[model samples]
Target: MKKIFENTQIAFALKSNNQLQLSYFLFKVMNSKLLVQLGTKILLLTLKLHLPVQNIIRKTIFSQFCGGVNEEDCLKVVDTLFTKEVSSVLDYAVEGKINEEEFDIAFVKTLKIIEFAKERQAIPFAVFKPTSFGRISLYEKITAKKILRDAEQEEWNRVVNRFDLVCQAAHQKDVPVLIDAEESWMQTAVDSLVLEMMRKYNTEKVIVYNTLQMYRYDRMEYLKKINQEAKQGAFYIGIKLVRGAYMEKENERAEENNYPSPICASKSETDENYNTALQYITENLEFFSLFAGTHNEISTYYLMELMQKKNIVANDFRIWFGQLYGMSDTISFNLAANGYNVAKYIPFGPVKEVIPYLIRRAQENTAVAGQTSRELEMIKKERSRRKQE
Candidate 1:
């Protein structure tokens, strides 16, 4: 098969020159670690102080990375991706709320998104973070094997009930709901809840998908165990595999608390582990639904090769690829153009509420060596190509 990711024309088809130039400037600023760190702190403080910075943020990083402030605001983004044969996974980007009422509101927002997904063919999945619906302290307690107080027990029940409500809505709508993975300290509870939902709704097909962050050293074993449970229980398991996003925080916490780090020793180890999990899931495709959520070219190409070797059809719903909105368009769009199943994780929320998510994206881009440079190079290449044409 021909290499599809290098075609810049398809990659940037929706980006106007002005938008491309803005991205170039943003990535250039993000390339400087000091600038990203300083900018992130200043932006967060300004947003907190109710300053008049939303307009610039709305135009720059937020517009580049997020879908919109609400579902209606995301329609243009959904339609543009649909035109390119790509699909969207609507993710409400609000996070870190500790109030029960806030959790209930997030649950209701999730149901609304599911109803929206049911009506829109362009939206392939609805996604939510487990922490968004549950208390982080409760999750940490569960992970630490601690007993909960009666009040805490009631809170946990509320969390479980919220998850059930959202999953039930998705089940009724015939839309798969993705449960995003968080830090390892709180992941066990998330894992257990996702499994419960899968057992309930995934008897025939995978309606509740659990994400596995392959950067963890023990995840391959976890994947094996989950696959066994799914097979024995006669239920299909949905797995979305990613390299993980909390490497720094995870390591820092482990060091501060004097625990062995759960992360893989190196990027190469994570890559090996991720590829192994992908191969195992694909080999047992009958019992698992695989979503390769990645931006790494090698991992993406490895998946394509695995599909070819396994004889998985190009358009198989059992296998799909995903990239985040505003990043990795070269992979997302070109793969969709080549008839591969692909979707983008399109996040949306009020500009101020979503600043943390946007800042994290910027920081990650800064930390990843050559990431912003690569994006800049590709944008420049496309612009030059267009000018020549």
Candidate 2:
């Protein structure tokens, strides 16, 4: 009997034993301590923004993990990814910006990205975070108390303006804009913002997508409600699901604040909801497009199974797969090899601006059970084979 999770194209991509020797070498650098330390200094320089280091970082880590600094810069990478049959979910990697000017810049930049996608006919989608256009204090206030202050209201409105620009651009260009989910404290605001865009722009089609962090126990119910609302309003539903990203921060917050953590109590619970969300979206994939953004082999396999079980085509426009650019080449490359629609979530920005993400990538690799070690072993194995041959 075939294991449902072991037979899909994605599974083959992830678990294949015959990858090029160079494959493991790439993974090793992403997981290496030397690289991590070097990345730290580069990050500090980036934070101070010497600005000259941008090119070096761009040439190295950013080149490896991100698409490019701007739309035109992204085209070559986009074309390369397309040739390999992987799409590009282009995200501008400007994190930690906090001011009105910054917000305005972010909004304009996003609209341009949408227009750029349209012109290329190459980029399927783009994404954004609320913090890119508003203050954390405003979001946290709305999340914790479910209300806002007058000044906060002004900021919120600015955030809305930002969304309006981007969503309008996406609608005009006929591309979907994915509003990324955030930590629990601020997700209420983020969700509300995404809902507004969906209500306005999604009536004709899924021009906007709100991420569902399935690691949260409450999200499945929320997913159901959102779809119900979509049906009532006669709008298309768009979704992307992922196991939570801020596990440690969420747990620490709960410990510090004396509240129950919002993250799944265990990985098993998280995985269960993940599959449920996959099933939910597939059930409606005829009108809705969904992306599974994960590096988990089993989740990808189960989604492939669901497609087949429901008689959906592996190449259906309604379904897609994505992973961070550097971390899951095995899963990503293999999916491309097998003719499925997959993407690399290529983030590019100034090095300092993106260090936090880079560090998290390093830490995530180190923390995943045996991931770092397995990656290291593979690199060594391949390196040895190369030396002798």
Candidate 3:
């Protein structure tokens, strides 16, 4: 069972000797919590001071994590993955914008990406964030049941229009689009909008996909209700399932608000919830399609085992495995090699703008027990095997 993820040669085939060394160095640095915290501050400060550190950042961590700063820049990365039978989920990684102009810009960029995906066999899905298309305040107010002023209503309309534009393009181009999940507070509005898009575009098939974060204690029940709604509406539901990325922030918010936390009681609880949701989806396979986004070896193998037990083919269109770029190469490449439908979440944006994303990645690696250690161990094993050759 472990051998599926043990083929480091295929995993590292995309990296050169020097690139491998740099990745090893980066992961080693990320393994230290103190260094990652200190280095993150310094990196942001230097960037704010207009220091010319982008080159160094680009060559090291950025090169490993991001596809590039723009769509054209990602061509080579997509091509390389296609050679190994892996598809790319092109993600516009820009974050932290509050203006309408920026939202419109990201919306246009997403449309262009959908159009780009229409022609590229290597690119299978396009992903964007709801916050990227509108103001957080608008979503928050809507979630909180606050009455919107006329001006605020206009702004919310614009956001809804932007979402429609992107989803419409995806539907027209026959490309699926993933709407990323966010904090639980604002997720109600996001869910409403994504379902509206699903009602519009998912009638024929699953063109609009919603991300489900299984770390939330209520999501398994939520999935059941969503599935029932989809069935009642006679529309297919597309889901990208993950264990969630904002556990600490979510718990902190719940504590600050003096409310019970929505997070699962333990990691084991989250894992069980995720597997249960997957089984539920499998049971109703005719009404749903799933993309399992995880780096956990046990979960990946469990999905494979589920598919096998259910007599599903290795390359079933209804099931997919995903990991982020620059990490979990072993899982991604090996899955693709074994004829599983697989893709990596390839993030791209300006180096400076993507710093937040990179910092979170580094912090996650450090905080998630044994994540960096496991990566380092695999990289060292690969390098050793190469040397022995």
Q: After superposition, how far is residue 219 of candidate 2 from its true place, in Å?
A: 1.1
lDDT of 2 by residue, 98-205 (tens): 889987877777787787777765688978877888888878888777667687788788778888888888898898888888899999878887888888988877
lDDT of 1 at 231: 76
- Poorest 10 consecutive residues of model 3 by lDDT? 1-10
Q: How does model 3 score by TM-score?
A: 0.98
Compared with the true structure, all predictions reach lDDT values of 0.91, 0.76, 0.92
Clashing pairs in 3: none
- The candidate, 1 or 2, that scores higher on TM-score is 1
lDDT score, residue 372, model 3?
A: 91
**Over 4 Å off in model 2, which ranges?**
1-56, 373-389
lDDT of 3 by residue, 1-389 (tens): 54578889999898888988998999999999999999999998999899999999999899989999999999999999889998998888988899989999899999989988999989989999999999888899999989999999999999999999889999999999999998998888998999999999999889999999999999988899988998899999999999998899999999999999999999999999999988889889999989999999988898888888899998998898999998999999999999999998999999999999999899888988888998999999999999999
Q: Taking the candidates one at a time, how many backbone clashes does each contain?
A: 0, 0, 0
TM-score of model 2 (CA atoms): 0.86
